[model samples]
Target: MIPELCDQRIRQFINGSDFVLAMNEDNHVFSWGDNHCGQCGRKATPFRVYLKPEVISDLNDKNITHICCGFKHSLALTTDGQVYGWGSYYEQYQNAEGSDTRVINSCENHYKSFFEELSDNPIGSGGFGTVFKVRHRFDEHIYAVKRIHKEDEIKNHMEVKNLVKVRSKYVVQYYNSWTEGIILYIQMELCEYNLQNILEVKLQVFGRQLGEAMDSVEYLISCEIFRQVLESVQYLHELNPQIIHRDLKPENILITLGKAMDCVEYLISCEIFRQILESVQYLHEMNPQIIHRDLKPENILIAENIRNGRFVKLCDFGLATVHDKRVHYRTTQKHTADVGDMRYIAPEVSQGGKYGHKCDIYSLALIGGNIFEIDLFNLELEDTNVYSELYQILNEPVYRLQTILISMFRTRLWHRRPECSEVLSEYNEWSIDRNILANDTRFDGILSILQSNDNHLFIELSAIGSGGFGTVFKVKHRFEEHIYAIKRVEIKDESEEYLQRFYNEVKNLIKVRSEYCVQYYNSWTEGNILYIHMELCEHNLQNILEVKQQVFDRKLGKAMDCVEYLISCEIFRQILESVQYLHEMNPQIIHRDLKPEN
Candidate 1:
């Protein structure tokens, strides 16, 4: 029988066998069944039977909408929007004095009295117990109230202990829990919709039925969501407790809908990407490795306020466990199987071997694949090997989405994927390259020069600067009346080897066309002297710095501003950009002597 309850229009159903289930108006599960082991407090009977139904005393006056049930545990939500749970699952595992084999009745007296004093407003539920939304009796501050069953008090206590030790932006915050009579209550940060709800929304917005009118803004928003999720997971994995959200799924993730609805469209800008990358980098640097066994879109949450949207948090750590380096490697050799979601499980995890953090990497890739519409799951393998297919996907240039997805899906447990640091590095490199390519015009101009063979502007000029590799000269083009700086080198230095080197540098510089980078103009050679003409600037960055030391006062401030402005300018940006580009290029070039001066 289905029973409707709560102001939010929550409904409950007692299945044929006697299990009671509650659901919110949105149709999300709120609570289900009896906690004999404190698995269901309100429905306790001397003997545990599937058909018996009992109403929770605390829930009878309120409307509860959704519930989540974990192994031997249950959570409940009221229509008045208050959340509560009376189950022994968490307590039994957590309480130090609790015995593992104790029967259901030993905790009934303790359970009956725990439901008395709680201000209502239902939020959600989890495996261990129910979480309620509550406003402080005095301050009206919102909080998540978790009700743990007496039977499961030991487990609940242990979870709380672990929660206290974990500190990370990605993991949900745990406040405090106390017992009044029979019910145990835990208060935490109040969250909105779970990841499942958000995904449903995204699915609707992107589905074929949505047609061509699918907004780019929405696509961008989704990308931001994906980025935030990764960052949160990365953070959790880097914690001191090294927490992993083993049950990461859509239902576990909670989004602040009110925040999302109020956020402006442009809030997910480049700055947001920067913050995301920075956070990822921070997590990778943390000590003691953390690996998330479960990583899917559902485990990642999005906070309200788009610019502030980076509050993507990872939730649901019921199955999380800590592992050291030795333990981690040993587990892979032992062929342990507890790892991830089926669709996102890495091949190694599926093979039932020792898997490490790469499992998380694989799942992250799946999330990306889903969001970007990349067919990573069905991609044609380069060979019979899945790893080869993954590599090929990473190398593919046309579909950036596929490349990122494949990179995250490395098939081998060891060589199959990059560590969090590597993943973060690659992302930064990509972002930097993208930004440089988008704003710089130097490459376009150089291409124009290469395309034209006109020799009308070539002319001899006086020397400007000299170095071991080449000499620069102030030159004026005869036809265009343009003043340019030219670098002259011996013919031997202009040979194919040197020419290739020069071209590489030019290519690197072109890629970074920032205002601070020395601009390339044109190139040619006269007999033994090879010449390269470039844009003429009065001072280089080093020259300006020297000027700053000698000329203090208002000029110093101006000089500093000039230096900062130039560094931020397209030219200087290109300089640093070129350095990074060359560093990652084929064979990996190193700028051996980087300093204030060349």
Candidate 2:
């Protein structure tokens, strides 16, 4: 067996003869062994000793996303899309320092004075100091002012640095930060409602509904919130420093309304949820990686009257830190930081055992469970024993899907936990197949659009194909004992006129059954999502063609554009028969779109 390397924190490294360089998850390049030519992005002096891991501060603001160490020179790729070089420069390292600045005009409409507030009741205050809602005089745009006390300056500089570095819709934006000797003033985007307040409101209104299954509306709302939080954390992990929000609680996040939604299109929330999962999926798949040690309900923000909470964002990076994301398995050494929320902290994190991104996954699972039970938002539990709720979440069957998700976080064992991407995939899917199944299930090999016992009757598996209109998934029905492909078509417009056309097409599809054509088994619509089940084929034409190409290459010693004469003849014959069958219908049916996939 290969031995595991102790250098788990290094994102990537390059070895060279004279010197060896390593870049950590924090995006700081560490050079050691030898630095004969100042290849480590540092100044050379007569008594300079080239040794252990030292940060290349010049590339700090650039937020270097990637790095490449050359024999005589090194390249630092920043997140801003600019490339900085150091070492045996093409002009001595291309001066990777202040070259990043592109000066703006003398008088930009940016928030310059956050210190001066028109009306100061003060919005909120904490260890960071008081925050007040402020408006710029020139632009007349409203902004939030976070006034940090003078004593906290030296200690909180890193947090200030992170705010200025990151720019994301989910994360609160930073406008300007300044120090006036005694105090530090920061101008940032204003969030009207904090997540903690929103959670309380949500619980107060929807607490009674916990016993019943969440409707499409509630599911979509929760999903959107979950997605944004994961995405924001993912963004922080991808940064050069690979930040982890150690204090991810709802009180830290803020929400704003961006758009207005009408009464008709609540299903559009489906799209919003997908966008969130995609962003988070990108985060879990990062190299060095990021794990938010603090992931609780308080960190999740929801926008009010904004498309029914469509535009949510994650905020608060107070206890955020750049950790060694490269480390996978827990180390023998214990981490004794009381950083995260007590209820949501992963066992590994709580026990001081070394952990990774899965810790964030655990926290998110707890948050999801708490949100489902409405226990996460209720302020009454703040003074009461929260452990009972955590215990119930662990033992009770209140959240079936959440129980499955929370299983990952029950122990300190890293191998037991699911990745963020996996959780996102399963959660984003429609799990209320039972409700749909209750409506119908009279069909055969094509499982009924919705069988009476849908959960037991059929299982929707992996995706087969995707198109502009819909996506197709490979599925199997337990009763039918046959594999089938189901197409989930998106309803473009919710009107009888458009729906009638779909019904007519389905009616036509059902009647013209033939050996030469794909056998259509079922068709149905539930809400906006549509389903069309059909017979599963051995292979698609593309796969068949590729296999045939490989065979021809071996036998004939040359690649052929088309298949063999006899095989091509059979394919053409089948195609013609299918076309003929379609044409012979009552009113000749014409397929406007025809390709290998079809």
Candidate 3:
């Protein structure tokens, strides 16, 4: 077998009268076998036979969608409607006036011949150029075409270089780029809305407040969007001579709806098959990390039109930097100091100090705080005071989402900030831990039993008791109509000894099935909180003592009498028997604080 043929993944194969043609998944055309009458689409030789497959270089210029063969010729149809033919028939008109010239001319400006601007007005514009929505004439698929003026060639070329080098689904897809006279054109995958637009719309819906707390659904969506953004940035960082998007803000991120192309192309009339999406992966592994000096909300884009699921795409690599790890650190002396947005720029960058990839993490910290509606600290303030304020905010109770941000908010202490991978790993751990309470099937029984008549589950009717370990709440199971005392405990940050003691209490409840002991129902843990469901008693010993004293005063008008003494003696006897039951066990269990409250 031909080594090249073996390496290429052939998507389609065909046979001509004296030759064979194959189109690979990448849309590159290859030919083997007989080369008679130029049917092989290669240099015509005297022998007219080729055992090894050779790729047709001309067809590679276009995205050949389909290929077919005639008796002594082969034809290729490009995505742009242009048809290419080779072999004896084309040789007949090789010397015809303008026929050969026309073919050469068509290949010269393939971009112009295939794509046309959909509208006169550009969809987006920046310092380098205006971006227009264009449609491929043959495929009729829409794309974004950025037209950059020659005056901004440096920035435009840098962006093109980075976009072409990085191949990631989270990053905006790059197609083709070319120079025409004084303008440079770049074709890219089209996306609908940027994060800036999404946040503005959300702000309007939430009473136009900047720090308005996002509801549960909105919070989850924000987490997903932010996670994708992190993934894209991580991709840049992972690249050797890492790419740093010095400009990462909400305006640069785009969003669009998922495509239904799979359904449109399906031939079978089955619902299950129609839901599948075209499989493609754009992952590339490399050494080092990229620094996006200007990392903020405006640089992120979201695509809703994806077949699998909607995701955010990173764009505008104009301010990105390919930082080589050999250099160790980068100083702002060679670059413009005021290039990034003032609000999102890291302290080191703004202060003209040496900086590195952690700058992006600092920006991420601020963006994360904004996403969770946490108050944004004053960036211009002294690092000491700012960190102090943050410390105070963290001292109190906070959402797990906000806690992750703390590790990224080292501010002036850039080294303390965690890398993108570390931060993402921690965030994923927290997310999975919390999800167990709701999604794990093992907790379904406890969850179902905790439901109450109110809209919320696990509603506490009353606090029946309290101790060092946890609190006991009087609750009623909605479906079972059974009242149960549920003990809620905070196990987070507790010592191993404390945890072991708590588990011992639970074990004792389970093992001792005596009538004197409280009945244990169920137990479960959610995140840091531990819960135990037990039988709810109507009254404790203290309540009984007070009630008996009141009855005696009303009836006999005196203190304790002979009959009252006998009643007290019986209560004492039961307490002794309960203690005796514990002592009888091989490994005795002790009630350390045996009082009326117990």
Ranking by TM-score: 3, 2, 1
**Every candidate's lDDT:** 0.53, 0.58, 0.64
Per TM-score, the best of the predicted structures is 3
* TM per prediction: 0.25, 0.30, 0.33
Tell me how many clashing residue pairs each candidate has: 69, 8, 33
Candidate 2 positional error at 50, Å: 3.3
| Runs with alpha carbons beyond 4 Å of true place in candidate 3 | 15-20, 32-61, 69-74, 86-92, 96-118, 126-129, 135-143, 147-189, 196-221, 231-252, 257-598
Winner of 1 and 2 under lDDT: 2
Per-residue C-alpha lDDT of model 3 across residues 1-598, encoded as one tens digit per residue: 6687886889889998767899988778888876656767766555554657888865554557899987767788865466777766654554443121212113547667878886788888877788888878777777888888888667877787677577478788877665666777778888756788777766543233677675433455578789988888898898889888998999888875333222111112111111111000010012455566665667765556764543545556677665555655543333345457666676666656666666766667666655444433311222333221212332222334345566566434777776555544444333323332454354555455455323234456899888888998998776567778899888867789878977877888898877979989778777677788889886889888778877776454656788888998999999999989988887887778798978
Output the lDDT of residue 62, model 2: 43
- Can you write out model 1's per-residue Cα lDDT over 325-381, one digit (the tens) per residue? 676665544435745666555666665666555566666666655543444534433
Model 1 lDDT at residue 167: 36
Q: Which structure is stronger by lDDT: 1 or 3?
A: 3
**Candidate 3 lDDT score relative to the true structure:** 0.64
